[model samples]
Target: MIPLAWYLIFSAALFCIGLFGALARKNAVAILMGVELMLNAVNVNLIAFWHYYAQMRSTPYVHGLAFTTMVFVVAAAEVAVGLALVISAYRRRQTPVVDELTLLKG
Candidate 1:
């Protein structure tokens, strides 16, 4: 069986990449993508932990799976809302770069 540390390391790397993208990018869409990536990383961690702990207990793994599903649902909602706002901002301001949105007028 694959080791748990490997899964954790991979998830950590994914999270770091997402964090960097979110922090370094100026485009709202890119930032949203980064946020999605980070959320995915979190899902990965949750599944990995669930798998690792599944052996220790006889209980079903639905708890972790359900939580992961909820995370996905929330992420989708967040993406939809975030993109809608970005589109609205772009329509009014003509720029997707976040730094230009100082005044919430648009």
Candidate 2:
């Protein structure tokens, strides 16, 4: 049987990789992918905790799965909105590189 610590370690590694990608990447789409990776890592942790802790009690937590599902839905919405913003920015500037988007002089 796989250990819970291994799962947690993998999730943490994935989150860290995503964070690094988001911070280091210049392209807007690459950053978006990194954000999605981070979200997926969080989702994996949530589901793992739900599966291991929430289901162990005699009276299981019925709402754990529901909460995780809601989180996934919210993540999906966030990705959609973020990608739409990136697309709009690309259309306006013809460049999807984050470092080149310094034209917002207000």
Candidate 2 is scored at a TM of 0.88
Error of 1 at 64 (Å): 0.7
What lDDT would each prediction earn against the true structure? 0.92, 0.84
- lDDT tens digits by residue: candidate 2, 18-94: 99999999998899888888988887888788778855777778565787788789878988998998888888899
Runs off by more than 4 Å, candidate 1: 103-106
Q: For each candidate, what TM-score against the reference?
A: 0.93, 0.88
Candidate 1 weakest ten by summed lDDT: 97-106
Winning candidate number (lDDT): 1
**Pairs clashing within candidate 2:** none
RMSD of each candidate relative to the true structure: 1.6, 1.5
Best by TM-score: 1
